[model samples]
Target chain A: EAGVTQFPSHSVIEKGQTVTLRCDPISGHDNLYWYRRVMGKEIKFLLHFVKESKQDESGMPNNRFLAERTGGTYSTLKVQPAELEDSGVYFCASSQDGRVYGYTFGSGTRLTVV
Target chain B: LAKTTQPISMDSYEGQEVNITCSHNNIATNDYITWYQQFPSQGPRFIIQGYKTKVTNEVASLFIPADRKSSTLSLPRVSLSDTAVYYCLVGGLGTGGFKTIFGAGTRLFVKA
Candidate 1:
C-alpha cells in the first residue's frame, strides 16, 4: 500500500502571507491526522479527522490555522497571516484505526516564514 | 497522556545488540507503549507496540514488564543503517479524547 504523501516538501513564505499544505492519505484510511514540529521541539499533534468529519482538533495552536478534509481521503492545512513562529515541519498521518493500530506518517512539509 | 523519559542519545556498533528503555511512571492501565523510528529528513515509522510482556517482529522486539510503566525496545545485530531517532510514545492512539505527544526520542548512533 502507498504511504501517506505530502506535497511541496519545503515552502518558504513571507510573514503575513498565507500558506496551504496538502496531504494524501493511504487508500481506505479513514483516520487522518496532522502534526507539526518546530525547530528544537517535539512533534505535536494538530488535529485528527475520521472521514470528512473532524474528530479532534485540540492540538491546533490558534485561530489562524485551519484544516479541512473534504473527501475524507486527503487533507489540507492552511495557515493564514503566517508568522515567523509558524515556521516548522508539518506532518500528515493516517491509520486504519487510530486507537487500535499504528499510523503512517508522511515525509512532512518544511515551512519557513521569512 | 503519560510523559516518557528516555536517554537523549546512545552509541552502538555494528553487529551489536542495542536496548533502549523508556520510563513512564504514571502510565495508566489502558495505555499502550509504542516505538517509532524516524530517519533523517523522513517521517516517523512505527516499530512496535505492546501492552505487556513481550512482542517481537521482524524489525525489533518490545519488552514490557508487569508494571507497564516502563518498556524496552531491543534491536539485534544492528547495522549502521539502523542509526536513527527512536521515539517512545505512551497512551492510547484513540480516535477521540486523547492528547498526542512525543517525548525527546533516543538518538542511536550505530558505528561501523
Candidate 2:
C-alpha cells in the first residue's frame, strides 16, 4: 500500500495570496487528518475527515483556513489571504481505523508566506 | 488526551541501544502509549505502541509500566539512520473527536 502523498512539496506565496495544499491518503483508508507546525512550535491538528464528511474541525486556527475531503479519497487545505504567520509546514495524515493503529503522515508541504 | 514529557535531546553511539523515556503522569485508564520517529523535512513514522507491559517489534520495543504514567521506547543497535526526533503520544483508543498532539519530541543524535 502506498503511503500518504502530498503535492508541491514546498510552496511560497505573498502575504495576501491564497494557497492550497493537497493530500492523497492510502487506498481504502477512511480517515484523513490535517496538521500544521509553525517554526519552533509543536505540530497541531487542524481537522479530520471520515469519508467525505468532516469528523472534527475544532482545531482549525481561523476563518481563513478551510479543509475539504471530497469523495473521501483526497483532502485539500486552503489558506486564503495567507499571512506571514502562516508560513510553516502543513502535514496530512491518514489511518485505516482509529482503534487499530496510529496515523501515517505525508512528507508535508512547506509553505512560506512572505 | 494526556500531556507527555520527554527529554529534549539524547546522544548515543552507533551499534548501541538507545532508550528514551516519556512521562504522562495523568494518563487515564484507556490511554495507550505510542511513539513516532521523524526526520528532517519528513513526516513522522510509527515506531511502536503498547498499553501495558512490553511490546516488541522488528524495529523497536515499547515498555509501559503498570502505573501507565510513564513509558520507554527502546531501539536496539541503532545506526545513523536512527538519528531523528521521537515523539511520545498518549491517548485513548476510542476517544472520538479528540486530536493527537505531538510535543517538541526528543532529538536523538547518533555518533559514529
Candidate 3:
C-alpha cells in the first residue's frame, strides 16, 4: 500500500505571504493529524480531523493558521500572513480510529519563510 | 498528556546493542509509551510501543518495567544507518482526542 503523501516537499515564501500544505493519508484511514517541528525543537501537534470533522483543534497556534479536511480523505493546512517563525517542517499522519497503533506519517513539507 | 524525558544524545558502534531509556514519572494508567526513529529530512517512523513488560518487533525491542515509570528501546546490532534522532512519546486515545507530545529526543550516533 502506498504511504501517506505530502505535496511540495519544500516551500519558501516571503513574510506576510500565504502558504498552504497538503497531506494525503492512506486509504480507509479515518483519522488525520497535522504536526509541525520548528528548527531544533520538538514536533508539535497542530490539529486533528476525524472524517471531515475537526476532532481536536486546541493545538492550533493562532487564528492565522487554518486546517481543513474536506470529506475526510485529505487535509490542508494554511498559514496566512506567514511570519519568519512560521518556518518549519510540517508533518501529516493518519491512523485507523485514531489509535496509537498503525499511525503512519508522511515525509513532511519543509516551509521556509524569508 | 504525559511528558517524557530522554538523553540528549548517545554513542554506539556497529555490531553493538544500543539502549535508549526514557522516563515518564507522571504517566497515567491509560498512557502508553512509544518510540519513533527519524532520519534527516524525513518524518518520524514508529519503532516500538509498550504498555508494560516487554514488546519486541522485527526492528527493535521495547522494555517497560512494572511501575511503568520508564521504558527502554533496544536496537540490536545497530549500524551506521541507525544513526538518527529517537523520540519517546507518552499518550493515549482519550475522550478529548489524540494529542501526541514529543520531547527533545535522543540523537543516537552509530559509528563503525
Reference-based lDDT, each prediction: 0.91, 0.91, 0.92
Model 3 chain B poorest 10 in a row by lDDT: B90-99
- Per-prediction DockQ, in order? 0.67, 0.66, 0.66
- Ten consecutive residues with minimal summed lDDT in candidate 3 chain A? A94-103
Cα RMSD (angstroms) for every candidate in the order listed: 1.1, 1.1, 1.1
lDDT of 3 by residue, A2-106 (tens): 899999899999999999999999999888999999887889999988889999998999999999998889899999989999999999998877776567999
User: What is the lDDT ranking, best to worst?
Assistant: 3, 1, 2
- What is the per-candidate TM-score for chain B? 0.96, 0.96, 0.96
Best by DockQ: 1
Residue clash pairs of candidate 3: none
User: Which digits, one per residue and each the tens of the lDDT, describe model 1 over residues B39-69?
Assistant: 9889999999999999999999999999888
| Candidate 2: residue A52 lDDT (0-100) | 90
What are the runs in model 1 whose C-alpha is more than 4 Å off? B93-97
Q: Residue B67 of candidate 1: its Cα lDDT?
A: 88
Error of 2 at B19 (Å): 0.7
Model 2: colliding residue pairs: none
Residue lDDT tens for model 1, A40-113: 99999899898999898999999999999998888999999899999999999888777634689999999999
Looking at model 2 chain A, which ten-residue stretch has the lowest summed lDDT? A94-103
Candidate 1's TM-score:
0.97
Residue-wise C-alpha lDDT for candidate 2, range A2-107, written one tens digit per residue:
8999997999999999999999999988888899999999999898888898888999999999898888889999999899999999999888776425589999
